[model samples]
Target: MITEESIQQFSKNCENIFTQIRRDVIGQQEVVEGTVIAMIAGGNVLLEGVPGVGKTRLVRTLGRVFDMPFSRIQFTPDLMPADVTGTNIIVKGEDGNSQFQFQPGPIFSNIVLADEINRATPKTQSALLEAMQEHTVTVMGVSRKMKEPFFVLATQNPIEQDGTYPLPEAQMDRFMFNLIVPNPGLDELMAIVNMTQKTMAEVAEPVCSGEELLKMRETANQVPVAEEVMRYAMTLCSATHPNSDCASEAAKKYVRLGASPRAGQALISAAKVKALMNGRFNVAYSDVNALAAPVLRHRMKLNFEAIADRVAPDAIVKMIVEEVGTRFGLNPKKEEAAAKAESKKGLFSGKKA
Candidate 1:
């Protein structure tokens, strides 16, 4: 059960985390918040942006804020699976006899920064599938569990596609949120430059630990979701599938592939955390709507028509939210005001007659 005291503590911990992150990161508040939400929800994040947008910096800052063992894997085409998951090497034993010993790679860390993940080949990329989902790495038919509060914060360049490989759907589905890191504005840019001038090192201190982060995840799991809100969340996810019974018009027209069942799971899980962050004890429709874009964007596959027409996934998600919200009567207060205005209009027409 979740107590009020626990909820207050969760919010305070989150505030402290953000305060520490701000010391290193300047802008891109939405991306930062979404990354934090996914981390607390015990899910992986896929960050898409152009070069030099603080994607790598955000992951580094998070490692410091969480006070976890951090490792950086600069993904490239030449990178191999063995380089990431490590391999068994022959070593001399005490008696001078050679024996096989396992050497763990950078994946065996609390927080891993896979910078420019798309630069790696599909074969190399597949190496992370098991670790991201099962939180274990299998090498030579042996499995090793990841450390507590494990997270993989991967980044990819969106504009450079010359040698980059697209992330497969199976791998894409493993991510909880695919956040876009937009460039900072004029003022934020100035602030970043000024801050960097002082020191190139990350100055943020650790405010949360691996154990505390796991506790936060446990607390978020206890935040209750009303039946109607739960159904609505499922409906929104279902609407993404054009072939589903609850398909929205936008999905029917633009989407080629809808989000998987994992999307619904992620939606509710993240919404619970969002509610707790807002000091609410229960999940609400607004929380689901606010998170729909980040949760569903990368999971969705836009049709060729959408691509040719330059209709981005974010725009399609927005349209789907509005369509579903209207059908579900998401806001009763607005509906009541509209009904009252219609009644007054009818009365005025009767007086004119």
Candidate 2:
């Protein structure tokens, strides 16, 4: 049992890890925090960012902080499945007999930085989908268990689409969150320059071992979520469908495919972890609200109208949140009306920086 005292210890350990990571990463605090959340929750993440945003550096710093065997796989179109999951090699034994031994690939590492994951062919990308979801690899018709506390942080170059294989809907749904790493602000950039100019302390150190991390995740799962909160999460996901009476105005017009019931499961699972992270014994409505964007972003699909209208997934999530309202006791129509009014006020107006 993870007691309150251990929870405090986990928080302290995470702070130390963040302290080490911040030394090297001057900006992108949100990205680093999201990565930590996913890792602690035992969920995989897809980081979408433009080039030169230090996505790789974040993963490297994370690997160092967790004190795990980190591996980087530069995904390419020609990459094969065997390359990601190692093949059985014929090793010569000392007894002069040759036998097949499974040599693990990068996917076997505790932390895998799938750099430019979209650049890999679908076949190679499919290889990872199983590992990300099941935390195991099936090679040569044999299933091999992965190391405990395994996590995959995959980065995608949104600007570079050509020659890149797009992840299908099934594969995309495997990710718990799609975090967008934006460019740093002016002050953050200045801090980066100054930090680089000085003889600063190194920004990569392990604060906790793999065993401790697995324990923390187990504890996170144990956090209590009320039946009402679970119902709220379900309503939020279900209301995104256009045909459903619960559909939000934006979802009806812009969304093609609504989120699956797995999203409902993910919402509650993640919300439980989030509550524990926030030092709460029980999950709250605010916890569910805060997680709506990340939970629903990648799971929902945008149609041609949305693509032409430039409606983003975040925008759709926001509409759903407003439609569902912070308090689910009221009728759904009121919130749907509120969502329309917000959009009319140009809710999705600002440029996504």
Candidate 3:
């Protein structure tokens, strides 16, 4: 069971970790927070941005802050499946007999940075789907389990698409959050330059251990969500589906495919963590609304019309949230006022017309 003290401790630990990471990583606070939330939720993250936007730096900073064994795999077209997972190699035994031995690869680490993940071919990208989903790799009919609290933070350069392969849909769904790393503002850029100039970059110290992270996950799971609030999450998810009963007009017009059930699960898990971080014991409607974009952006597929109109997935998700909130009567202040009025009127009294 998670005690109040544990929850408070978890939040404090995460705050310290974030503070340490910020000492190195300059901007993109949303990206950092989304990654941290996904980490606590025990989910994989897909980061998309132009090169030199500090996506890789964010992942590396996170690795240092968590103090976990970190590995970076620079995915390339020629990279094979065996390069990601382990492969069996023949080795000489003490008795001079040759035997096959399984050598672990970079995926065995606690934190893995799949740098330039889209640069790899589909065959190479598929290699990670298993480990991301099941936390295990099966090679040559042998199955090996990864260490506890495994996380894969992948980065892709959006502008350089000539030699890149789009991530397969199956593999895309395996990620919990697909965050867009925006370019830094003027002040942020200045800060970045100053931080890097005339000295070695500061290194993030470990603020918490892997065990403490797992405990934080447990505490986040204990955050209660009201049934109405949960229903709002479900309704928002279904609304992303084109032509569904709950779908918004934009979804029907522009979306080729809606978000998956995994998106709904991500919303709840992330919302719970967000609530705890905000010092709340119960999830509020606002928490789910805040996380809808990162949780749904990659999940929702846009149609040709959307492309022609230059409509981004983020816009469609925002529209869906607005439509769903209205449909589900999610105005908290208004609802609370109505409840107060009802209580004042008494249970059996008839309304005066």
Candidate achieving the largest lDDT: 1
Tens-digit per-residue lDDT, 185-290, candidate 3 = 9999999888889565667889878999998999999888999999999988899898788888989999999989999999999989877765678887777887
Q: Which stretches of candidate 1 lie over 4 Å from their true place?
A: 331-353
lDDT of 3: 0.86
Q: After superposition, how far is residue 106 of candidate 1 from its true place, in Å?
A: 0.5
Q: What is the lDDT of candidate 1?
A: 0.88
Q: Candidate 3's error at 119, in angstroms?
A: 0.3
As for candidate 1, its clashing pairs are none
TM-score, candidate number 1: 0.93
Instruction: Kindly provide the TM-score of model 2 when superposed on the true structure, using C-alpha atoms.
Output: 0.89
Clashes of each: 0, 0, 0
Off by over 4 Å in 2: 199-202, 326-353
Off by over 4 Å in 3: 331-353
**Local error of candidate 2 at 100, Å?**
1.9
Per-model C-alpha lDDT, please?
0.88, 0.79, 0.86
Q: Which sequence of candidate numbers ranks them by TM-score, best first?
A: 1, 3, 2
TM-score, per-candidate, Cα-based: 0.93, 0.89, 0.92
